[model samples]
Target: MAKDHTDPIKDLRHNTAQPFEAARAMPPSVYMSDSFLNEELTHIFSKDWFCVGRADSLAEPGDYTTCELAGQPIIVIRDRDGALRAMSNVCLHRMSTLLHGRGKTRAIVCPYHAWTYNLDGSLRGAPGMTRNTGFCKDAYHLPEIRCEEWLGWVFICLNEDTPPVAEQLADVEDLVAGYDMTNYTETFFEEHVWDTNWKVLAENFMESYHLPVCHAGTIGGLSKLEDMVCPPGLPAFNYHTILKDDQLRIAMAHPSNDRLKGDERRTTFLLAIYPSLMITLTPGYFWYLSLHPKGPGQVHIRFGGGMSDDYAGDEDAQSNFEALKTLLDDVNVEDRGCTEKVYRGLCSDHAVPGHLSHLERPNYDFAQYLMARLEEGRAD
Candidate 1:
């Protein structure tokens, strides 16, 4: 066997603890090591409450969506009784994945040996199992997973002992209350795989430092670094506020509402709920990215956004929606190019951690969250 290499966690531990003023980016190997990815899957994603999608998507009974959490296949269904339920999508009989995508389905049927389950994951039928005297359908429901709904979004936790989503994000809820997220209607949603480390994407969304450079031709001209203010990170999240230019399309399209006052009407909040969820809220609209690490070098992103009720029902909604989507598509193209290049740079032999700018406080907070979780895993 080849000699073992030093673990990247050693570097992560040292770099993460440094004071913010002297802090460096996480070690390059933290973005490229399989071992480090495994640790994150176990200590962070598996235990953290992460949003997958808005609950409104499952409005009708029988509507369901399938997703993967930290590599384990899961299905979220609106049961016949109008309750939302989440459970393993794996067929209990032969271990085949039961659902391929989202749609209306009376029941989940395995494409393999015809094993069937009710919307609530109860085994409804398992053809040929009748011959086995020891088989009991009632005892074999698809393993249930813990799930919660907050501000119209559905969150799931692989580890049942983790705190509830509401409890973890109470402060965030209060901060964005004026936007009325609970009533926001999702107008668009998509999934994409990015060729970059998951943390790279998360950090990219958390800061405005790159906006002036990477998005210069698009929304960059609207941003001013001196006007961006990053508040300290909390146990569950980090957020930054920035004043929006009234000339931007989004600002111009937003309807005035009594829910916000003074500068609140002109400010946008960008938040990263620890581990995965990224949310951007404005008086006019909101959008979010729920990130899932596919591995050290890839991320599965669930991107969705919506308009506040005031604008969602406006006569100009469709035209505005089309315009916003086009703008976002262009921004994503720019982000994908930049992040993929960063991943490539990190893989180079000369790659080394560099001191972070004050503008990168959110990235520093993310590093702290990573270190805390890794340490918790070690203690366990």
Candidate 2:
């Protein structure tokens, strides 16, 4: 057992660094407005880089994968030279999907017109069309999206104009550099369609206020109720750090002593990349979450997990990690259930924007930033 000390001032300061202001309340309309969601897809999702899948999905040359981002279908593949590329899944001829599913395809073939594209998204063959007669094979190739692989993730941006991931996330590089994600491998992947708006899930993920109450049984003990804080000034797109009770370190195999016993063996450190992606890094494991906006109040969430390769062939370790994932899923189910109901409440006449607690600075700041961007979009 570890030593326990009750320091109210330290705990209060940790959670109450930000001052509360009632005017900062985020109206429910932001969550339930069909129009607002569309704006988000255009202004937010299109303007930012999103982590769509893991690099391992296309680990080998010729391996291809597919996903949907901002309501547009996308295809990702590793070229013959092992470089990753992303392209719109739509065929240029008939707009039909080019690739059906993931596979090691020599060349992606469209079922509609049999148009074939190389793994690099170059037009290889258009079955019946001649290369002459002003029909340029190069001009008919698939439209490419700016995609990059970093720390084992495949990130794609619909906008060819967004800044590179490294540039956008320059400030948090030191924080991210602390992790060794190279050792992790997939441990779980799950997709859930929710009745709530994407922001509802975003808000739910932005703070730990609900953890002590909503997750009392599962993570209540693992997280410190008062110490949960996310320092402000983090970049708009990357909310990479979640400060929780240092005691959660016990959950990891590592042992520690002192006021920051678990910081070294953290059981909870989640990152939310704006628009739609959340990643959790913990000792011996981690997981990825991809969020898709189906409508203003409907969203789809995909969950995937990874572990260090050193633990790869070990069934015992794998089983333990899987159990942790199950626990996380159970907690997520609780979050989803309430969020859907919140979406309904947002549309109610009695709905009112709520104030932000000092500890919920990240949630408040994120909402404010999103609103400001949307307002800018409305202006433009």
True lDDT of residue 112, candidate 1: 93
Model 1, residue 128: C-alpha shift (Å): 3.2
lDDT of each: 0.86, 0.68
Can you give the lDDT of residue 131 in candidate 1? 83
| Lowest-sum lDDT 10-residue window in model 2 | 1-10
Measured over all alpha carbons after superposition, the RMSD of each candidate to the real structure, in angstroms, is 1.9, 9.0
Model 1 earns a TM-score of: 0.96
Question: In lDDT terms, how accurate is model 2?
Answer: 0.68
List, residue by residue over 1-380, the lDDT tens digit for candidate 2. 00134232232233334344543446555565555567788888877787766788677898887878777899888989989989989988789987855678899888988888888788888877874587778887778888886678778998766778877766555565545565567755667789887778877877777777788768766666565556664554545344445343223423221212446545356666666677776655677678878887688777788665545565576566667777878888788777877787877778765667765666666665675566566676
Q: lDDT (0-100) at residue 337 of candidate 2?
A: 73
Q: How far out, in Å, is residue 312 in model 2?
A: 4.4
